[model samples]
Structure formats: C-alpha cells, structure tokens
Target: MTLYGLTAAPVARRLGAVRPARARPLLVGGDPWAVELARALRSAGLEVLMWAGSEEQRERIREAGLELAPGELLAAATGRGARLEGITAVLLLTDEDDFNALASTVLSRGAGIPVHRLGPRSGDHGVVAPYGGDDTLLAPGLTRLGVAHRHAQGAHIVTHRVDTTAGTLPDRHDLLLLVRPDGRLVPADGRAAPAPQPGDIAVMRPRC
Candidate 1:
C-alpha cells in the first residue's frame, strides 16, 4: 500500500485505483446530518449501512429505518481485525474531526474499500474544509458538527443533471459529489472542483 498525505484524509490507498460503482455504502458515525444523508441515499436506491459509536445513535439509526453495520466491523475499525465486506465504500461522519481522521486510517489500511470523511481542523487554511479526508469527498472549512448544524439550518443536498443547452452550472465551487452515467463518482469539491458535464448527476450543497 502507498500512503499519500493529503489536505484530505491523508490515507494509504491499496494497490488499485479501479473504483466499483457505489451499490452499498457504509456510513460511520451518527450525526443528525449523517443520518439524513443515509435516508437520502436510500431513497436514491442504494443500500446504506449505518454504524454508530453510541447506543443512542444506534436507536436513532434504527428509528430512521436504516440498517446498522455488522458488529465485527467495529473490531476491524479499531485496528484489531479484518477488512469489511459487502459495502463498497465508507463515509466517516463522526463529530470529532480527529476521530474521523483516525478511523479512516484503520479502515483504509489494505482494505480496498474507499473511505471519505470530514476534513481535520488541524490546518490553518481553514476555509472550513470539506469532506475529502481520504480525498474522496469535499466541502469547505466546516467541521463535522459544524456541518450537522448547517443541515439543521436548512442547508441541503440536491442533484442536477448537467445540460449545456441551459448553460453551465451556476456555482461549481459548491459541488460535493459528481456521479457519472456509469455510476462512478468523481470528486468535484475543494480547489479542484471538476468541470460539470452533461450526463452527470452533480450533487451540490452550500459551502457552510
């Protein structure tokens, strides 16, 4: 495995770069926005597995009609076990920025499953930061809890199908996730927001 330090998660990528279409995603941590995201992803027709750090979170996940991640997955994330199975990707959404960063390390080590998390607050650039901890997701300078608070304030996630006939997307910089027609996700946040094109589902949220 090769480890690359990033303004994102700064994790070790396994031997290959071929990413599978995201059919099942494992969501780590149980924050208000994270729970809502899982609900949205499920409505979009993907199977989402929820894992919580506390029993309270577990109840919330269950109440939301979401599936909890397997028990063994906890041992794996703590660095005492094996790679997770079934889920193609992982999203670390813990409220603690450092905890999310640390979990990404254990989960990414030799585990081909792709991992993304909220950016750490350790840096001074602090434009808020986006979710790209593993360099997968992107956002502004907000911490995990900060994002949750934003969601409560009516910030939202929406998808737009690019159509040149109507001109280009108005705010490309606020982009978070880009889903290609083939189901591959292209990162389009941070300073390197990819140009939006037709036939792609652009998931966008505000910088806050």
Candidate 2:
C-alpha cells in the first residue's frame, strides 16, 4: 500500500539495505496499534511475540492469525530461555501510558534494544538520539502512524509537480526519492544524485 506516495517497494528496498540481515523477534505490548505493527513487521519477515493484557485482546490477536504469548513470558523470552536471538528492536503498543513507559525502560536497559512507543496523541512524534535510543509517539489516527514510521525510518519527504492538464508523472518516473545514508537517491533507472551528505535535501521537477 502507498502512504503519501511512499510505497512498500521503495521503503522495503531502502530498509533492506540498512536493516540487519538476521531476523529479530519484536515484542509487542497488546493493543490495536500493536496488531497492525505486528502485521507490518511480519510482512518484512520478522517474528512477533504478542503480550496481550486480556482474553479479549488475545482473541483479537488470534483472529488476526498471529502467535500469542503471555506478558510474563516476554521477560523470559528476552532472558535465558529465549528461543530467538539477535533481537534488533522492540515496539511498545499498549494503550496505557505508564505501562508503555515502563516497557520502554526495561527493553532499553535489560535487552539493549531500540524501542518504539505508541502514545495517545493527535500526530506522530519521535525523538532519535545518537546514543542508540529512540521513541516514536503515535497519535489517535492510523494515517499519522504511517507518517510517523516513515519519518522514524529517516525517509525524506518529497513533493512532485503533477500536471493537472496531462496527469501525474509516468509510472517509470520517480515521484519520490528515498535518501540513502550517504545522501544519494535510488531510483529504478539507476540514476544517482551528487553525494548528499547528511542534512541535505534533494528536489527535482519533471521536464515540461
């Protein structure tokens, strides 16, 4: 699916290049947002361990066809008896603010994992630091969540000029460019921009 012209294809490609090869089990705190995040993570070939708080939540997770584990089991999974290894990240999706905050602290301190938290706000907000800690604050709506994810993933925002008379850009034309770590843009035609060191934004307009 496309979100603000950012599709999974480009997002996945850029993510693949930067993401570690080993699959990590994402520990999700139970909620609707967690459910959706689990789907997206699984689609990216990552394992998910759901820690739902109630039977109703468990049933909802089961209906979604995902694996479920008790919240208590999460501490164990991240501990000695862990069946999975190389946990790359953690997602805190619980509705309760206190619970999510506690989980974030534990995951970061105990497992040394990067944590993304969903909060009760109106727009997506995030804080990323050089010390390997980041927080993603999610609002009430789903669209904002996607925007938040892309922003967290460090995707560059691009606005293309669409000719109202002729229509949008051609399918082969690059409407949005996913910026790389070195500041280069990746497109289908193998064209690259001048190296864009960090903090540079690239803008291009289609020829009339």
TM-score of each: 0.69, 0.46
Quote the lDDT for 48 in model 1: 81
Q: Ten consecutive residues with minimal summed lDDT in candidate 1?
A: 1-10
Q: How does model 1 score by TM-score?
A: 0.69
What are the per-model numbers of colliding residue pairs?
10, 0
Lowest summed lDDT over 10 consecutive residues: which window, candidate 2?
Answer: 1-10
Off by over 4 Å in 2: 1-21, 74-86, 120-134, 139-208
* Residue pairs with clashing backbones, model 1: 9-133, 127-141, 128-140, 128-141, 128-142, 129-140, 129-141, 130-139, 131-137, 132-135
lDDT of 2 by residue, 81-115 (tens): 32334345555555554455445554554454455
Q: Candidate 1 on 30-142: residue-level lDDT in tens?
A: 77778887776665556788877678888899999999865544354444443444566777676666566655665576447666776765565333333324453565554
CA-RMSD of model 2:
13.6
